[model samples]
Target: MIHKQVVNHRQIAWLVGSLLMTGMMISFLRSVVQVARMDAWFSQILPIFYALFIAYVLSGLVEAYPGKNIFEILFIIGGKWIGGAINLLILFYIWIILAIDIKGAADFLHISLLPTTPLEVILLVFVLLMMYYGKTSLEVAARVNEFYFPLYFIMCISLYFLLVNEYNVERLEPILTSSLDRIVVSNFLPVGVYGDIFLIGAFLHAIVEPRLFFAAMKHGVIIVGFGTTIMLLVLLGVMGFMIASRLNFPIYILVQQIHVTDFLDRVEMILFSVWFPAFTIKVIVAYLAFLVGVGTFGGQRHYNTFNAPCGWFIVVSSIFGFPNVAHIDQFISYSLPLIVLVFQLPLAIFLLIHVRRKNKGREQSLIPEGTKLYRFYRSMVWITTVCLSGCVIVILIGDFFKDKSAVGGIATAIVFIALLLIALLTSYGEMQALNHGKQKLGRAKQAGSFRQ
Candidate 1:
């Protein structure tokens, strides 16, 4: 068995966030934009929900059976024959994906950077890196993710923030114009990308505190999910869905417009430098997970033993797997979602069926509505309600000012802003009233005690 690594919750969370950044920009963005159009930003909601639920369920299962990962759980719960079959299936899935990731990274680097360098050369270098990663401990891999995620995060955010000038809010003007069926379909499109978080099941054994594994996974996923949501919006907000959807990598082209100063013109390379590592780390994590799973399943050989052989195998398969960019793109765009669901649904059902059920009420009581997470969501809920209400009011009252002139537009803007402010003030007033009431009750109780 591979040694347990002392990785903290925060560090692993960063790994999850880092793993997601590259995939979102390169692959996940354009596909959703094509289907959802203006509403593509909200498509992240489905995957986020699904991913978190999977995390919660998987973690709960991990906690129930201490020290054992889901793969091992399959064996214990089902015994060798049946469990081994399922285990092999999951391993097979991971191996296919790991190979695909290696190829995808090579393809990306070849097209974006070392065009003069042969593809096989790039593939060789990448496979060697994965071989090194596979041979290393989980702690080492986590540290690499820790370092790269922030650099990737800052580069993407800074470049996008600078593009505020280019963002035409009108590009996102007509919301939910797409049919209901289209919106639901678009939501499922990104599931394949996000469902990779299920690989967290492989990561459970490495965590220093396995109990908090789900918490770290959830936080990490939230960062990715929200970040991805904002990224899609920005892509649509700056470049209309028409333009955003057409490009294979909208974010790359989007960053090309980042000519901050005369000297800093064409700094997409800077962003690319950060993003390349970001993408590579994602592959490393997936590769490492596969290796770790392999190590545990055998109980005899070290995971590192397979790393070189498997890495070379992947190198060859990757070259063949992605015959061209279009082939991989088609596979990812269409085939991937089905594969994700096939793996995800069965695993989830199996865990839910077999996992040790903890005290439901006790668990619910632990995270009261007053907690930071719940409060933040409550505040967001209120804000969304107020904004949506304001929009509806504007639409309803907007008919009165039928002149589609500058005056009418200004009036609509003013009305929307006014209603939004009023709603916010009312919510604020309610909060103050509740606080005042609590303070008054405290004083009254003090006086009553003093008299006694």
Candidate 2:
């Protein structure tokens, strides 16, 4: 229940653009290159479909329920218990993402900028800054993004130009030569990377011009997509996939190669300084999402009360989340993509279905009085219940048979079952409420007739 603040479309665009672009300049390039090889640049094209679909769905949601963010819409569609459960789940996901970014950024700084400094101190300072940003209103954060993104963008462009002399056109040869399985799998990588587009839903209510929401998101996604693709191509052409993939931070290595003259040797430091604001914006936005979700679920009007405690928790978790850089790389390369899809895609599709029903007026008409439609709706509900039960049973049996350590898999299965049960309960509650309201109206109408 955070107070809504109006932000212009340009500010929203800048914030999102900075968030997407920040990850591109970090360890993400190496992950993409690992799967797509020299054609990793081409893989950037694959996420456009995901971005467009998500944008379209979010825009429709905003248009249908003006001035209500996704969390409020979820409450209307699913009721308090179910919607709060989903919000908690999304909040957990955002927390994990923020922690991972904090850890990664701190690791980068420790390795390159402050080799002698304690990692704990670095993480503490970074998380404190993010907490400060989180405490501020969304409008303030949006204004900060508007101010810094242009400087960051210009630095990126200049970095590309500085590396032009190092590009080798021959390195990009033999495109599409990777196995079809590998290439198709490679596409999912970027889809996960770009999944942050869905986060824009949380901020939709604060946007000043609802009609321009989709346009702003589209422009930001396009800029990030093309910027990443071009940067990957340059990295591959200049350093080749072999050298680029081996480096912990390929973009840093690429920047290190830029030597304009005798005096301009260590320009990588300058690039590093320019990129920090973009990275900070990413963490701040994620933290903002966590604050908003928590507040919305707890029925609080403001989230500033929880910011410090959550920030401290994130700082501790990030410091211990991964023992070292290799663990971070492994999670990014394997676990991250699946986690992103599991949490993001199903929730989005569910909301899309609900929004469609709402827009069509089918939501209220589903249980029409004394009609076949009511019976049909009941039948569909029964079928859905049966299917969900079967899914739970199948998942339990599969985990028991296939997993050596069934704890994680079983936990996941339980969560899915809980989600289904919540949805069913919410629908029942809504039906009961609707029927009670209709009966009240009938009684009032009878009283009016008697008075006449």
Candidate 3:
């Protein structure tokens, strides 16, 4: 058996910070702008709720499986064929995420930072940095997170202070009047943005304790959610929702409104400095996930060999994914539900169920015990499932048939998501039962060995 390396607590904390903030920076706010127009900030409630539910369920699944990463769990649940199929889906999802990260970074820089810099050069630097870091182990990634988070947090706080003068409460005054339907229908932006938290399951085996899974995730979500809500509020208040939605970098636009006297007119640069590192961490995380998925799915060998090819694929695919930024914007707005259903939800439910079933047979005979923290995690699946189900229900109700002009199609979408969430939860509940039994047996075996 291959020895599994463990990441330390500090690094794990950083990893969580990097992942959470990365979600905030990449597509969440921008996607919201594309949908609800001036009302995008307010419209985010539905998607935020949905994304949180998905995050909880995804974390719960990782908790239930103990030492298995998502790929191994897939195989256990569906056998080779079905599991392979699910893996393939995950592979594609990772690919898309990497592509988006690359493109978003390059695009943001080109539009805002170094306007004349070649896009290839910008993307190449990022890809190389990620490739170097990706090979360094999860410990390295986490270490970087811990090292940089202080500076990152400080810069973020300073940014808020710099821009505080620009806020306008009148802009957010008419929060709910945009035809409740329109406000609801526009929430796909945040949903698409935050739902990527599901990808963290790829690292379940790499973390110290699976029980800490939800703890880390819940903390991250609250941070991102609350931070985002505040940022959006600031954006709406400062720039007015109409103007805020019109700017490509809503944050940048807000930064420009800063007036801490004429001396600090270029505060946007400071914001970019803070924002750039956060963005780098996002790309790094995506690249790391891609490398791991390749290694895990390719029979657990040659991770380094796969890095260059995967990086190149991210480069090429990003260039080809959309004709231009407009298309990317449109896709983020309308195609989100399809992406969530086909990729995030199905895979999560499948893996959770698969693990539970396999755990059932192990109830009779067990081997050396794993971590105690991991066992506590396997027990929490039912509680998580119930909470997640309720959250999903709220999202569906809030967002369902939100397109008043296109009520029929919207209702269909709502019903479909509801059905998917239910199926996933029921399937996962069964798997949790099996996983719990396996843990019990394993404990028994350990106890007998101790007596001997």
Candidate 4:
């Protein structure tokens, strides 16, 4: 039997992070700004955690089917027809994403890089290159992403420092200017952007260290989430929410504003060198994912066998699939998150029910259930999170609730976050202690068996 290549945890984490950074950074801003207004930066936090929670919860499927990708697991647990139907629905989801992003990136380039060039020409070139790269396996893509992701990450982070002079703290003022309900509901868009985390399900089988999947996602979520929050923060500080929200691509404009030294006026192109790869790599990863789903569906050994057709289909659909960038933005803002949740929650519940039934008598625990100590630590973590969340909310929106100002609310929020971090660290320490104990017990059992 031919063996599939495996990717380590770090590779999976960085690959997923790079994939998410593209969409969130590129075109995810306008909707959130419109809805959340000045508080758009704050709006990012909840959706990020939401994505991580969903990824962690659905990972039960990975533990249940230790040797299979999501596609394979669905085939086994969902049965042939059910699995086939679900996979097909996934293909549709992937197609819409590919179509929208491919078009969005193309439009961005046509507007930014090659204003004189025809948009269709740009689209054709981008699609051909993506198709060529998509032919490569996930292992190859992960390696390339790992090698260059650091440079991309460093350049992005450096933006905060470079644009420090442009920052106006006052712009972020009147904290929580948007209505609480609107801001909460506005989360659906950025959260929809974070919903790309769901795509990680496709590649779980490629993970060489199955035990480290959650750790990998944690790393990915932190990088993507932190990066996005900073981007929104910088934009708000630089241009204020009013200007930041009105623009089609605020990030692009933000980059253009960087006047490095007197001689170097527009280094946007230099950053484009960084941003282009960041943008295209996500599309490339999506392409690879699409091929995986299709390969399983059509039973092809070489995923590229259908690459041309799929590539062209995406290209044509992209051109006509979205009327304009506005439509894409609106869909991402309003529609996509719901679509992702509708598909994901049901599928997870369906798989969960089936997994419990099939593994009724089997060892359902992967590592171990929460011991009493572990549960206690876990409760502390939850309490700390709630406290921190309350502090931030009270500081921002407490004006509506009380007559007196929420004095020192920011300081209170900072203190709560520090405590939350301690809670998390202690919880991790307890987990390690528990794991060591379990390992010793397992070794003792093995020794007894061998003696017999």
Report the C-alpha lDDT of model 4 over 1-452, residue by residue, as the tens digit.
00265776667668768877777666678778878777676565567567667566545666677766677777776689998999998888888888878888877877777889988998899889988886677777778788677677777778888898888877866655567787677666776677777667777666543335655665566567556666777888899878888898889999888876999877888887877776677788788778778877776546768889888888988899886888888887778889877886677667767666765676432234455544653564466356435645653544364234444434433453453344335434433433453454467577852110
lDDT of 3 by residue, 351-393 (tens): 5565456445544212123545344344444454554455445
**For every model in order, what is the number of clashing pairs?**
0, 0, 3, 0
Question: In model 2, which runs have C-alpha deviations exceeding 4 angstroms?
Answer: 361-452
Tens-digit lDDT track for model 1 on 249-334? 68888888776788777788877877777788888888877887777677733687788877888789778777876666667666
Q: Write the per-residue lDDT of candidate 2 for residues 1-452, one digit (tens) a residue.
A: 35658876667667767767886676877887888787676565457557756876897797678787788878887788898788777777787778778888888889988999999999889988988888787787788888788788777657667888887867865444445456566768877668877777777678543335655665566567656766776798899888888889899889899988888779888877778887788788888888887778767778888889989998898777876777777676677778778878888888788777766752332133554444544554455345444543544443344334435444543444453444334333333433443444467568852110
In what order do the candidates fall by lDDT, top score first?
A: 2, 4, 1, 3
On TM-score, the leading prediction is: 4
Evaluate all candidate structures by whole-model CA lDDT and list the values in order.
0.68, 0.70, 0.60, 0.69
Give the CA lDDT, 0 to 100, for residue 45 in model 4. Answer: 56
- Give me the overall lDDT of model 1: 0.68
Among all windows of 10 consecutive residues in model 4, the one with the lowest summed lDDT is 401-410
Could you tell which candidate, 3 or 4, scores higher by TM-score?
4
Ranking by TM-score: 4, 1, 2, 3
User: Considering only N, C-alpha and C atoms within 3 Å, which residue pairs clash in candidate 3?
Assistant: 77-354, 168-237, 356-431
Worst 10 residues of 2 by lDDT: 362-371
